[model samples]
Target: MNTGKAHKSGLRVVASHSSLWGRFLQGDRHAFAEIYEAHIDDLFHYGMHFCQEKERVKDCLQDLFQDLWSSRAHLSPNVLHIRYYLLSSLRRRLLRALRKDRRYQHRESWEAFEFEYTLPQENQLIINETIAEQKRLLHKALSSLTRRQREAIYLRFFQNLRYDEVAEIMSMQVDSVYNTISKAIGLLKKQLPLPLLLLLLGK
Candidate 1:
């Protein structure tokens, strides 16, 4: 697995983002803009998953960046992943905004992470019936998971966050995050072949 190479790569990522964060905190306009460019799409993606309203997501993102710039002087310099920091900020903003709006009163908590699998036209035609059925089963199993379970999976796999980062973002204990992901994976394993399951889960 080339553990040494992997460790070096991880350190590189931390150094890159940590340096950028420091620059931004020092009031570097270019660094601030670069951070926005790198994370805006991912923030928006996570926002949409948390709340389906596109306009709301855009509004929250705009506000988030605006606030970041305004408050940069007081911001902490310890951010390792700008993506993770921005995601956590956007999440808080969305939840607060949703709570204030009377229309969203029915949503007592964050809903399950929602997603659909899609294939390109050429690839779709080549997918046999067996594979199609397996896809259906996978989707069904995903839907059956609790909101927290689905969210843990999304942040762990789709967002590619470390388990500890996911725990912090979700306000869960590290042990709880491990258990949640383990349970979710166990359930998914029952629905598909091991080879296909690993591929679908982005393992």
Candidate 2:
């Protein structure tokens, strides 16, 4: 997920997804299916952060895409980044589904819906030994941060959402999002050794 390359790729993604969104809104079922196929993996992966149940995640996605296709004509006419919009949409629907489930009714803690992100695997590691070790340390440090801290970092950096977009998804003020990410990065810097940031960032 090279960030430098990703940043450039993101621009192309915005254009393509936006065009697909328009086509879908104009009643193109193929365009809608393209949207579903393009984002299903990331949406499902993000949903698992809230609930580990494989079937539940798959069910929710099925329902979401079904409802989305059925109601495509009524959806927004534009979407700048399909990935960002789908991630936020999936998060909302998954939580709503979890809330209705009898087993999770009593456990309403925010930690139950905490964000989870894993470090790049060994094969994805940087070429340098020291940096690779630092990447391992950073993965450990991630566990020590609060849920909100991790979510803020993931949405802002990994998901590439704008600050306001992240704030809306997390239901926080834009300023709060800025502060949270600033603090989260500071904590990561303290937890991670020098020059490992880029390696851990998947650059």
Candidate 3:
């Protein structure tokens, strides 16, 4: 089927789905606004995980949406989830940014930048202060991983991409992706305390 027809058919599956995707396909401002509102936080966190620089992540996000809008005319309405596509695009943009910027070339492991202490605040509205301590510990653990391990973990768990998709994005062989994810998970399992790991696994 043609892109538009397929999109229309997909929309018929649900009212909420049709309205949002339809508006996005047609370049509606309010629709795009809703989309941004729904996704910005997740996107920011994902970008922060990879880029490590706040300003660079912000700039990359701006460039990402601009490119998405510019190319929206060619999009398939049947695209079930736009968030995944945007994230893949953002990853590419981040890699490009790293390649072009020398300052981002620090080869030190992210663990070197981990916070040494936990916070005891739960009064903030914007930030989930209750989760601050756990978040810091998790962040420190994540930072301890190698760059490839971090990317593999993010792609597998955070972005929810398949091994093949991750391999393609990272320009590595499928076996490499699989090995990287396995190694990363193994390391995390070993390093995290049993209780915390169980909490993470909901066990």
Candidate 4:
């Protein structure tokens, strides 16, 4: 899973968000709104992956922004990927909410969270020359993965986060994140032909 180009693209995204965050921290109200608008959809999607209650995720997102604004002075002034920070923050809030509601009292850790990734439409998959047959195989391979494995792969490949960034978001060690994603890919390899596997993953 070589993504040198994708990694470089992440650097560009980092620069973009970091500048916006700096402006927001400087008390620019418009920058703050822009930041919220930029991330709200992504935050909602990521939150849905971890929690079944979509409405709760929406409420938590509202609360997250409220709390962030209230504590703006104490917040980090810059970030490479604002979504990573938002996801990290949102996870804590949602987990606490779960505990408060006694829904996950039996689970002591984040590992108990379940994740599901809905693939884009078949036509969407072909933007990179992937065919309909490849998309079918890719979906099957993705479905075969455990929730944690799928999450690791999603963050590492789909989200284009660095291993360290993914580690922080997923509350895993860097080495562990590497291993998880590697195992996930190994599983996919067993199910897909070599070319199809690379095509599905490399995009």
Candidate with top lDDT is 1
129-181, model 2: which lDDT tens digit per residue?
56446545766766667677777777777677877788899999977877777
Runs in model 1 lying further than 4 Å from the true structure: 1-17, 108-112, 118-127, 193-203
Clashing residue pairs in all predictions, respectively, total 0, 0, 0, 0
User: How do the predictions measure up, each by TM-score?
Assistant: 0.78, 0.71, 0.64, 0.71
Q: Candidate 4: global Cα-lDDT?
A: 0.72
lDDT of 3 at 118: 44
lDDT of 2: 0.71
Q: What lDDT would each prediction earn against the true structure?
A: 0.77, 0.71, 0.69, 0.72
How does residue 96 of candidate 4 score in lDDT?
Answer: 84
CA shift at 31, candidate 3, in angstroms?
Answer: 2.1
For residues 91-150, write the lDDT of model 1, one tens digit per residue.
899989998999988763445487576644554465555567767776787677778888
In terms of lDDT, which candidate is stronger, 3 or 4? 4
Which of 1 and 2 is ahead in lDDT? 1
How far residue 30's Cα lies from its native spot in candidate 4, in Å, is: 0.5
